[model samples]
Target: MWKLERCPPHTGHQYLYHGSEEEELHVSRQVGAWLRLQGDASISRKHASLKVSHSAQAVKRSICGSIELKELGAKNGTFVKHSNSQNSAESEAREAPVFTEEHRLSSGTEVVLRHGDVVRFGLYDYCYRLVRCELLVATSMLPRSDTVMRDLLLLGGSYSKEWTQNCTLLVMETIKLSAKVACALACGRSVVRPDYLTQLCTAVKQKQQQLPATRDYLPTITEASIQPDPSLFDPNHDRKSVLSGKLFLLSSPKLLKRVQCIVEFAGGKCEVVAARHHSMIEAGDAVILRTPDDANLPSQSPMAAACKVVKRAGLHVVRESDVVLAVLYCSTERFCNPALSQQVLVSTISQSQMQQQNTGIIYAPETQAISNSPASVLSSRSNKTTRTTSAIIPETPGSTGPSSTLIKSPFTPAATATIARA
Candidate 1:
């Protein structure tokens, strides 16, 4: 089966319609049998017809079919914006152009619709997303005449006019209702119980309040906080001691306790500071551990003010993702190198952006030289340090004497090492 769900910017009562295989569903301003779309003057009396067709080898418990949208001869035309998943590399590389742009369907013309496709009727602010519905039983076996959609909407508290007035609440409630209804239908229950829906919605609302808000700010490395610890340089010490000599100034309130625990457990120091206490940040090597909510901070916000102070001081501003990566790989050497730090920041930002967009694109980071193994990362860091330093000494393969070489360490100004050959 297929379902058409009303998208955001709700102008009228929320709309949700279901169509079975080989069924022709009509969309118009009329309220009789047709999917009613009100408050849109651009919608004609007979706007469009959705022709549903099932696949030859349709699975019993899955949505497997296609929908052909036929445009009626109306004053305005039908337009569609294909989903991001369809706009792949192969689609772009083809000689024939994919419908990357909003494509209009000529009168009497038909086009096959894909899942997540947003269809608009005329030029007004009315749009609906086409979605697939997977049911446990066959479409033919289910009751043809029933109030399942209406009951589901009412049970989820989204069928009221007041609910549709608030666009954000409408969308959120609709998503919740859709999930509950889909689960019930998948389990062979056409109707969702009101008690069960109420319980589920309450739990979901509580969880949403607890989760962190999403933000768009990407962490950039303009300055490197290279407080090198001799313990970190030594391979014999445990990797948890990598943060031995560093102090972190955390500004994000939501992630303050969580990040503080992580930093303290790794043998590092932490200080909590607000916007008024800019002086406290001076003592810390790295200021401001950026979180997802940082993007939403206004200029007048305390967190934003603290970030500006960190920027002006030219201190390293670490991201939550970067901290996780450093802890996972058990190496802070990348943060010491400005170039490597920038690379890591860019890769993390790309990954976050892709996830936000839900594009399902795989991002391969460019740091091929950096491996996951702590031993390999340590070897690479040593080789890189040796190459950049002015001091150079070649070991005689047959010699048995200890050779002295002078090299500069990131933590200290300079360090001397003796290499013994057998």
Candidate 2:
């Protein structure tokens, strides 16, 4: 059952009178039970229907929609959003969903609701959100008919576009990256393939040219293990930087995929180091993330029993959800790429550190006062190395990504969001 309240077409908070997983909650003026929008005259007696789902891993599509779209493949299930005229309040609106083709929503169609979703109803366009979600453990006490369905409550999801936009943004991320990769590979087989390959090779050379020479050097990791912002990423300070860096998610694959999406959207890269912390120190260098809780973890998840490896690595660990919002929030940075940073100096791992790490020991970089002038420093190899101050290496540069830092913050969103839609 899904309860919705403080919304239009209803007088107060109302419950869906829980239904079986085999059944859906139907909202209609004509239907007295379930949810009834009897107060709104502009809405059809049976204006729209909603279906709720719980398992994220389950195939989210409904057989009620077109099979063609299902065949096309959507990693997550397809959802709908009703398009309203600029003047959404006009009661005379006649545009309705185009049902000629299932799963295909033309401009003004009402969307079927999904997990963590809320939608609008009636000419006044009152919105709702899946605000309170709880898994009932004592379902045995309830009637068997309704017990199979996952219970949900959506209330006043939002009057503003924030919620919907965030959902849309996250959803669009997979679309964006997959499309780019598809195009890249497809083009690689064309006559332009040689040129494309050459361009990539040339770009790599250009990157190496920009990088300060790699010398065996120890970094001063004054930055806290999980600290997000340093003197460099202050958005108010207003400086250009390379936004692309690496993300290390020492957590579950589910979290890895989500964080990877956000990182790709931000033009960065990410790698998942499945909690075998010592094997991959660089994974924690740039940004480290973990699954917020064990709720969605799979059986035998490698991230299930991870310890303080993130903290000891001189990197801060953030929640999985925070990573997306934080990265999106960090788009405020002027310099968006690490390779394009003022100067990137990669700190290669020494054999000694690797050996020590295997024994479950972690070390923070020793703080050193950077010299004002270019100076020669002794490499671990005992060779003379010359470099400037203020360069930090990006963590996990070798990981696979669409290529994206993001400033760390408690992450209060701006007064307004960057995404707005009609």
Candidate 3:
């Protein structure tokens, strides 16, 4: 299969929506797609009007025996991002942009011909399919089809690693600057360049990074969990006890110490684990939240497909739920989105209550569960913007102590937590 993806150029203080079905809505009403332009096109603000298409009115591009773009060159130039290669012969063919003024393609832009490329346009999302080049070239209209297309084909292609690295740095810097500007405004400083979205391409690139890579799969981890033997729940088994199935946990790393105190007090285990790969959700595992730079893992990390499988299976369709429990490390200071905060609160409560109730003990309301802070009361100021942070507060109280309850880790006691009976 072929793959293709696209990013809209960030041009000044402007807005572009992926699309909308909700009738009449403002530009900001749309979700996901956004860019903030900053500086000039040289140092920063480089805007390129290109939209790579999988299927267009009159074109088809492919690679490795797959059709990458159904229709690449439309209104704006369709640019194909390529990876650099050596060997003049290989370099020449792979590097050239396969476009025509007859088709309106130019340098600094090339419709890549790679298999399994994920192409993202307004609504045309498709994977490359291997098809005959003879079929393609014969069908496409051109004065000198062989000459122009062949020359374009011979163009050397490689990904702009420097472009990516520079864009990444610029994005991080922009985010930092945006945060600073926010802080300054909070402290009553002039918010200059607040609307200058010239720096938005960097943000988009950063967002792309935030998206889970196709190579790896793991739902966001919001709390700590463990995997214990399923036999622990067997009535005939000679297990010590069966703890409550409910547990409440904080998802933020900053509040890990607090979560640890709560878990320990609740007579439960507390340890860090990676966000489970999508493949591992079925073994009854508990997800753990971690920072991205925290690189403490073996090469063959456990892969679980339960979370994704269940999600794709339409668990929400059956349950009608929106709050997905991911293992992410965010803060309370910037945690302003009510919908997100609501889900986080529910997840934490479920973790704590499950641990308390599953430990063979029913927690009574009169019982002094670990003291927890309310999430709703934290961010009452901003009604428009949603910020991400890690300073989550523990607002509610849960059961604690040996008499209180205990549930073993969900997976391997030492490995990632798969769900298990107390």
lDDT per residue for candidate 2 within 10-69, as digits (tens), equals: 445543322234555554556563555566565455455544433312212111110010
Model 2: per-residue Cα lDDT at residue 60: 20
Please give the CA lDDT of all the candidate structures: 0.41, 0.29, 0.23
Which candidate's TM-score is highest? 1
Give model 1's TM-score versus the native structure. 0.29
| Candidate 1 lDDT trough over 10 residues, lowest sum | 413-422
**Top lDDT: which candidate number?**
1
RMSD value for candidate 2:
23.2
> Model 1 residue 384 lDDT?
24
Tell me the lDDT of model 1 at 319: 48
For model 3, how does the per-residue alpha-carbon lDDT over 197-217 read when each residue is reduced to its tens digit? Answer: 222222333434232221121
**What's each prediction's TM-score?**
0.29, 0.23, 0.17
Each model's total of backbone clashes: 0, 21, 116
